[model samples]
Target: MELSFQTVLSQVMLGLNNGVFYAILSLGLAVIFGLLNIVNFVHGALYMLGAYVALLGYTMLGPLLGKPDFHLNYWVALIVAPLVVGLLGIGVERTMLRRLRKFDHLYGLLLTFGLALIIQGVFTNYFNVSGDAYDGKPESLEGAVNLGFMLFPKYRLWVIGISLLVCFATWFVIERTKLGSYLRAGTENPELVKAFGVNVPLMITLTYGYGAALAAFAGVLAAPIYSVSPVMGSEMIITVFAVVVIGGMGSIMGSIITGLLLGMVEGFTKVVYAPASSTVIFLIMVVVLLVKPTGLFGKES
Candidate 1:
């Protein structure tokens, strides 16, 4: 079969769309690891919860609010889900993660892993393995635009644009701003930052919340494209982790660039050989590991 230019272009665009989610999720992971120095295994579960919250808000909450005619739309989910999940993240960090901070890192990992399993289990029991569909899209973003080369969905373009914007905003805040400077300084020497009058503990909690919020934001964005399911995060978290590994944890810009690039590579792989699409990113990860164990942008310890 002769491959058409439009087909390839569309696939590339789709890949880029997927990459936005990867970038956001990995960026969250990078932020959390950079500041908190703990691997958050429950991030994917939080991502799943965000989608479920948006789903519930759209289908159940809207009707309960006496507005069945105008159901909760994507915009509402965009705002509410992150706040809800971020608050949940704060609770988790303060109540559980804080106590484990004095112990080995494995304790934190195990605790989060258990939390992920618990979250997934509860949702699975109620929602079952089959996915629930969220059909709400803002009316303003209902159509596709013909870009001469390809007809792209406006919502997708919005997603890509917004994701990039958020990613850059996050980068700028962490790398160039005063608050960001404090965060960087805290990560290196928490005692010193604390001695200088910074509330290091509170900052750590908020950083975790912010990371969770990022995951939730990505979930809300993804709800329109994928079904909201208990296992959705589990399926994607491993890939996002690989993206972090290939990009290097704690490197914000590295996470963003590697994610988008890998997404493009995966999309191109699908165009050339459909079966290898799933493993392409992992293959790249392996090669990167062999060549540079610290990752493309990671600094040597």
Candidate 2:
């Protein structure tokens, strides 16, 4: 089979789209790992929660607010979904995962894993579809744009660009700002930071909230591409975790870059070797682990 330039371009776009989600999800993982040192197995559940929240918002507003548009403003969902999910994260931090910090990382993982099951089960119980129905496409951004060779879906392009912005902005805040310094310092010496008058526990709470917010934001973006569903987060979280491992868990920039690069690689693999596409990320992770163990931009602790 011959591949045209347009075909290659389209495949590249597809890969980038996947990468965008990978980057965002992995970025959240990185943040939680950075401050709290937890693996956050419930992140996927939080992402699913975001989508469900948006779906609920659209539905509730239709009759109550006299708006039956069937689509929440993408920009509005972007803001509201994260805030709602972030608040939930704060609650989780206070109630469920707070005391576990002094325990083994496995405890956090198992706790989150159980939480994931509960969240998914509740959604499945109420929704009856195991996932939210596709809310349908946003009308405002439905067309395609002409690239050099291929016409790219406008929203896919938006996903790539907007996710990149969020990723880098997050990295910049963590790496270059005073808030970041306080965060890193608190992580390194929580007692000292606390003595210095920083509320270390509150910081921890916010950090997890921020990570959940990031996942939710990604979910809102995803609702436009894939249908919202309870299992959506569970489905993609494994691959994203592999992505985090391959990028080195602690590095924000590494996660973003690796996400985009791996996405492109997966896209090309799909076009060139469709059979390998499913397990491609994991296969790469295995090789990376054997070679460096720390990952592409990983450093030893």
Candidate 3:
């Protein structure tokens, strides 16, 4: 099969779209683990919930509300789904995570892992399809836009733009603001931060909620592109963990850049050698671990 420059550009674009999701999801994981010192194994499950929220809102909201003709639209679900999932995250932090702070960090990991399994099991029982169709792409974003080199889906372009915006905004808030300094301080010494009148517990809870919200936001963005299935989260999480590791665990900027670059690498590999596309990132991971176990941008703790 002969490939053109346009074909190559298209794959890069497709990979960029995928990279955007990875960047956002891994960003959430980085924030939670970097700040809270908790290994949030349920991050992927929350991402799954985000997609399901969008799916059910469009398909069943009207019926569930007894207004058969009315339905939740794409724009509303984009906002509502994250809010709903973030609230659930807040609930989890308050009720379950708060109690285990003094215990070993492994407890948090185990608890979240158990919660993830339970959530996946429940959804698996209800959605037993290869994937649930979600026709929620807004009409404005339905067609393809002509780039100078190639035509790209307008919805995908929107996703790349918006996801990038959100990721940068998050990085800015955490890396450059006064509130971020407080969060960092709280993370290092909560009692000291509390002594200065900051409600560290509330801050931690909100941070976790925000991280979960980021995952959900990615889910909403992804619904139109990927199949909404019970196993989607489980499938995506490992790759995301790789992204997080490669970028350096808890790195704010590393996750963003590494994910985009690795996705492009994966895309380009498909062009150069199809079989290596899937393992290229892992191969990179292996090399990075040997070279700098702390990760590319990861600092030694």
What TM-scores do the predictions have? 0.96, 0.94, 0.96
Stretches of candidate 3 off by over 4 Å are 1-3
Clashing pairs in 2: 131-229, 131-230, 132-229
- Across 1-301, the per-residue lDDT of candidate 1 in tens digits comes to 6899888888988999989989999999899998777888898999999898888888888578887765666787898999999999999999999998888888888898999999999999999577988888777887999988888999999999999999999999999999999999998899999999999999999999999999999999988888899999998899998998899985899999999988888887899899999998999999999999999889998
Give all candidates' CA lDDT scores.
0.90, 0.88, 0.88
What is the RMSD, in Å, between candidate 3 and the native fold over all Cα?
1.4
Supply candidate 2's per-residue lDDT for 216: 92
User: In candidate 2, how many Å is residue 146 off?
Assistant: 0.4
Ten contiguous residues with the weakest lDDT in model 3: 243-252
Clashing pairs in 1: none
Give the lDDT ranking, best first. Answer: 1, 3, 2
Candidate 3 at residue 116, lDDT? Answer: 93
lDDT of 3 by residue, 193-250 (tens): 8999999889989999999999898888889899999988988888888887889865
Put down candidate 2 lDDT per residue, 1-301, tens digits, no spaces: 9988778778988998999899999999998998888899999999988887777777766677776765566678889999999999999999989999888988999999999999989988777454456454577678999887788888888888989999999999999999999998987889999999998999999999999999999988888678777788898899998998899987889999999988999998898899999899999999999998989989886
